[model samples]
Target: MSKPVILCVDDERIVLDSLRTQLAAAFGDAYIYEGAEDAEEALDLINDLNEEGISVILIISDWLMPGIRGDELLIQIHKNYPNVIKILLTGQADEVAIDRAQKQANLHRCLSKPWSEAHLLETIKSGLSKL
Candidate 1:
């Protein structure tokens, strides 16, 4: 069976690279790390992975993307993949958006941008524990 996936969606290439590096260091080879620059691409990836019988265990997404916002994307994902853990990593998400995600998406956590590695890792570990 294909290994579970940890997907990160961000508009900025640097942020995606950082997340990829950090997640790789933390989880090693146990899970696949995938990155997408936009919500549409991320959704496509999710669909493709699912078609291959690869489950996406977690999603880390940014708030202010070009197309669908982070919360909306998470909400959409939750509709079909409620078991997937969703975390929003944003530098400018408002309270209303966060609240919506929490209520509608079963959001696992919301971390501010410029997030500390320790905190991010801890959140992921805690979320994983719940799964």
Candidate 2:
């Protein structure tokens, strides 16, 4: 079977590239890393992966995007894949959105933009440990 996937969604390509790089560096070949430039693309990618029998293990998304915000996208994902760990990597998400994600999506953590690599890794480790 293929390794589980970790999806990162951000409108900015640079941000997505950086996140993918960081994750790949930390986790190596243990998981598949994917990126989407928007919520629609992320959703499509998730569906495609699901069809391939590759489960998505985690999602890291930015809150301020062109289309759907992180919280809404996460909430939508939660309905179908509650087991997928959710983390919001946003610099401008409001408390209401974060709280909603926490309640509705079981959000694992919310980290500010320009996030510290160490903290991001630690958060992912702790979040995965719960599984």
Q: Rate the local accuracy (lDDT) of all candidates.
A: 0.97, 0.96
Question: Model 1, which residues run further than 4 Å from truth?
Answer: none
Q: For residues 1-131, what per-residue lDDT tens digits would candidate 1 score against the true structure?
A: 78899999999999999999999998899999999999999999999999999999999999999989999999999999999999999999999999999999999999998999999999999999989
Candidate 2, 4-92: lDDT as tens digits: 99999999999999999999999999999999999999999999999999999999999999989999999999999999999999999
* TM-score for each candidate, following the candidate numbering: 0.99, 0.98
lDDT of 2 at 117: 99
Question: In candidate 1, which residue pairs get closer than 3 Å at backbone N, Cα or C atoms, i.e. clash?
Answer: none
lDDT of 2: 0.96
Q: Pick the candidate with the highest TM-score.
A: 1
